[model samples]
Target: MKVYLDNVGERRLIGRADVPSEAGPVWIVRLFGSALIIKEHYTIGTVTHVPDGGARPLMERAVLLARGQPPELLPGWQALAP
Candidate 1:
């Protein structure tokens, strides 16, 4: 995931004060090896200020949550359903 993506669907570095509203039409996931997926996409984003392992591990936790697995959510987070 590009942490610096601008809100207009472009990949450019933005300041920390600038909030990002959009993520990607393509995402690069690296579980064992890196692979790019162009079909599935994320249109909106929510920011997480996890300073421990950064975004990757947080994303992994999200996967577990999706699969009804353990390792509950961190504080300041709520599971919302669409």
Candidate 2:
């Protein structure tokens, strides 16, 4: 999944991802082979990854939270961005 900062600099879920029913620290499982466990005190408008697989196996992953507006493409393809 990809994350981006909205106009007000709030962390907004973008790309192919889902938000939990209750906010705060939580782990999210995607349809494919990627996941993220957000922390309670994590910055709202930023991208983060669980460094060493606290909830899943270790894998090389990178996420680019939007600095402004999200890209105008369909889901599942945003990860290809640098």
Best model number under TM-score: 2
lDDT of 2 at 57: 42
**Per-candidate alpha-carbon RMSD to the true structure:** 14.9, 15.6
The runs of at least 3 residues in candidate 2 whose Cα sits more than 4 Å from the true structure, single-residue gaps closed, are 16-45, 48-70, 73-82
| Model 2 RMSD vs true structure | 15.6
Model 2 pairs in collision: 4-66
lDDT of 1 by residue, 1-82 (tens): 2233433334332222211324333222223333453222222343433467555433210111212221122222233333
After the best TM-score superposition of candidate 2, give how far the Cα of residue 63 lies from its true spot, in angstroms.
6.0
lDDT of 2 by residue, 34-56 (tens): 33442222122234445655764
TM-score of each: 0.18, 0.24
Q: For all candidates, what are the clash counts?
A: 0, 1
TM-score of 2: 0.24
Error in Å for residue 47 of model 1: 18
